[model samples]
Target: MPLATEMFEGHAINRSAAERRAATLTARRSVKKLHQAAWLVNAIRCIDLTTLAGDDTAARVRRLCAKALNPLAPHIKEGLGLGDMRLTTGAVCVYPTMVRHAAEALEGSGVPVASVATGFPAGLMPLDLRLAEIRYAVTEGADEIDIVITREHVLTGNWQALHDEISAMREACGKAHMKAILATGDLQTLRNVYAASMVAMQAGADFIKTSTGKEGVNATLPVSLVMIRALRDYGAATGYRIGFKPAGGMKAAKEALAWQILMKEELGREWLNPDLFRFGASSMLGDIERQLEHHVTGRYAASSRHAIA
Candidate 1:
């Protein structure tokens, strides 16, 4: 799995077929009542609980960590009949500067600190600077590093450069898990997305993500389908399971359920866990919380009622 072009040379993504399958995913696997509630709860546990912004602060990160520790209030958990089932977001994602604050706040909460590195959102910085950023975040106590890929490599067909860069990043990460952000919205074609996904997995990414949330089109079903198919193919051939994360524009409970259904149908039940899947979302948790409130009380609450932080 050392950046071989042959692995994806003949690989072609049928856009229409992928679209059809993505369309049927939600329609065929619609859940309701208790099932919907359970899926939402699972979504909460698989969320990265992210907050990556220009204005992110230590105080904001600490609050986000607190929320990750106790995603649902005691009364809300009791109302949902959760009993002793512990619920917590998979991790708390932040910018490199906020990694230590988040790690310190989440110290013994069983929640890992995820830092968006390699010049996240745009990733236009030099390679050395990007790798150094990853190392800096890891040194600051981040257990996971979400690194953005060089889109120019994909756009210019420089697959080897992309592979080498990602492989280097994986090495820089040391023991910290590495998530390769493809920024599918900027890749321009399903074929490019498919190729990028394959290259990232081959380069040793623990997770292949869809977007950085800055692109015009972020995390669409068509794009996710292409990426997940590549993940399935990689797992089948290598016997190594790579995680998938659909970041950006996912802000509703139903959307979360849709992605879950896609994972269940494409990768089976095993991929539906936090170890293999994650939602790189911020406002999404608020909507899921609102839906959970409705599930327990039978009445929809306003968005303001379920604060994300």
Candidate 2:
């Protein structure tokens, strides 16, 4: 669809109400024992296990890929009766230069390699340079490209500019899927978050991401509620189901359950799939693995035992 400001313009988001609703999502729906294990397993499938640091290396990316291939330890998998389940993370995300390493390592495993491109973490570069970065990532064998949107466009109410920028980046992605990072923390208000989300989806973003993890705040439930509502409204209008990712500041098994619960309640069970939802996390996997191990052994394992990379 084209840029449609009418969909989100003047849309009112009550922060207090959103916060109240988000709070209940976790408190009211509590899974225990086997059900909890099942949800955690499902969460593993929706995780975009990521490594996007300034000092990221090919070796580090390879190790990360290895973890994605076999997230749970053999003992934990066996204890849980997951015999040859072939569980793997939804994808492995990395810097553009590290895409080749992840692509080669995850080849034949049915796992996609996602690259954070278009001047990721802060898309402050020239549009041409950003588009070129996307092309480079695609040429490097990235199946998905995570592009960051310019916060200024949202802050200054430049919907046309924001839409045009993301649309061009989407074009540059070619055959690869594009996840537009809204960087909602910098957008100030929940209204801005909703508007940016609508514009990103209108510009053909396969997924609308909450943050880049470098902001002062990232992936709060209230902000996520606004984005999820925008996603629901867009689906209603266009009949197109878009994905959602809440990146950064999510580092616990409980947080994973909360977000999954949010998706299940707000968007139906269909959104629980990796194709529609994902957690952009690195260390969160460790916590999830730790919790699973405890569920199996009845004793909490040392955090080192579940180290991701």
Candidate 3:
């Protein structure tokens, strides 16, 4: 698809209405009992279980891959009356250096390997080096590349620069899908988030991510709502549906439900799948498993029994 340069030519966001709608969403809908359980299961499917750390090793990546493949043990699946359902996370995310380790470990598991690249957590590197990092991750068998945009471009009102930079990163990804992380917390305003989201999709980002999980303020309801609306408008204009990922600070199962509700309410039921929506989460899975266990046994399971790593 060609870039939708015209779509974001004069984009603007209504911050107050966005925040009010975000607040109203939670108050309007409540999923409980079997509905909540089912949503939690869906959350499991849409989780890009992540392990990005300094001490990450081959052993740790392998263990994380194992957990991704069998997020819900057979007993847990049976307990939920989903004996026929073989649930797994959407993908396993690791650093660029660990992409190969994750790829080899997750072989035959049907989970794509996602790698954080372009000097992730702080995209302050030169454009050439950042693009090279994306290609290297793709070569290492990463099925998805999560690249952080140059926040300076958005900060300085340089939409063209941001679009060109992300376009280059998307091209570097080649066959692998590219996810543009907006790091909304650092963008200063909801308008910046909206503009950044539009520029990323216009530049061919397969998904627009909320944060890098390292920022002081990661994903939040209001930020996510603004981005999702941008996605909706972009989809309407270009007819190319983009995906959304809300990362950071979303740990509990209830938080997962809140995001799911937001997606279902804002974008409709079609956005509930792993292809369209994903939670860039690590510890969130542990809490989801605990909740699932409680749903089955009518009691909470020990945290040890549902360890993610």
Candidate 4:
């Protein structure tokens, strides 16, 4: 290809991206201008409370995080052995310290590890500290690092601050994939999630994970729906097929399946895999087992629950 031709192609690509973004905004607004959800689902998600039974108040809150896989490993392994049939390719994401636990628990099991960092649930710490945490986790064998955005800054409309944090975190990822968590519960609006998705993708986020699975309100179908749409729009502009993950409070098999169905319908079969899509679930694994077993076997097994780590 000629140098001028290459340059022209790049410009055309850039312009086309801008137009797509513009169209998305117009479409989103038009849809919202007339139709919007009158209510948010107040129905409680089936999150196992054991995660919340931590040392103190903060520890208890942190415990609400979905890293508790020790109890659910065998079911996951058995479910994987079922082969060629699953609602979706399932993987377990745990905290950094628990990576080895999850790794050993999932050995030969094929499920990947996604570690939380950037002072997850509270990005009030220094950027260097956050980046180092990300680096250390990857070094310790994390397949993915789920870093929360510096919401204090992003919410202030500091796009540059937001961009730089994501850029640096992405660099710290090394060989591991980077999943930028917007923690949409804290972001508080669809507009914020949409814009944060754009910023993270441009800054090199490998995947745009929706929450910390902290039960902090970040993971919702609608919130994930918005972020996925934004990621799709950005990919059309920048040629990066950014991934999407809705991690928190996704405990029921039906809920996870609904998300998967939406993902398949919107992003195509390519996003149906664990690479581009995942449920950061704690209690949903057993449900998946129940689902698969009931389908493959005649009767559901009472032993379908976690084999007790």
TM-score per candidate: 0.98, 0.99, 0.97, 0.70
State which candidate has the highest TM-score: 2
| Candidate number that wins on TM-score, 1 or 2 | 2
Q: Give lDDT tens digits, candidate 4, residues 1-309.
A: 001112111221233443455344423432111111100010112122222112323333233323332322344335435233322234445556666655565456444566788887777788899888888787766777888898766577677778777888888998888888888888865667777777888888888878776645757666766777787777776677987877777666566556655565567867865556656655565554555455444456685343421
* lDDT tens readout by residue for model 2, 56-152: 9998999999999999999999999997798999999999999999999999999999999888888889999999999999999999999999999
Show where candidate 3 strays beyond 4 Å.
1-6
Ten residues in sequence with the least summed lDDT for candidate 2: 300-309
Q: What C-alpha lDDT, on a 0 to 100 scale, does residue 99 get in candidate 4?
A: 60
Taking all chains together, the TM-score of candidate 3 against the true structure is 0.97
For candidate 3, lDDT tens digit of each residue in 74-193?
777987788887788999999999999999998887899999999998999988999999989999999999999999999998888888899999999999999999999999988888
How do the residues 1-309 of candidate 1 rate in per-residue lDDT, one tens digit apiece? Answer: 688788787787788999998998888777998998899999999999999888988899999998998888676799988868888999999999999999899888789999999988889999999999999999999999999999999999999999999999999999999999999999988999999999999999999999998889899888998899899888888899999999998888889999999999888999899999999998888888888888888888876676557
- Full-model lDDT for every candidate: 0.91, 0.93, 0.91, 0.59
Candidate 1, residue 86: the lDDT equals 80
Error of 3 at 154 (Å): 0.3
Candidate 2 or 1, higher lDDT: 2
Residue ranges of candidate 4 with Cα displaced over 4 Å: 1-90, 104-110, 297-306
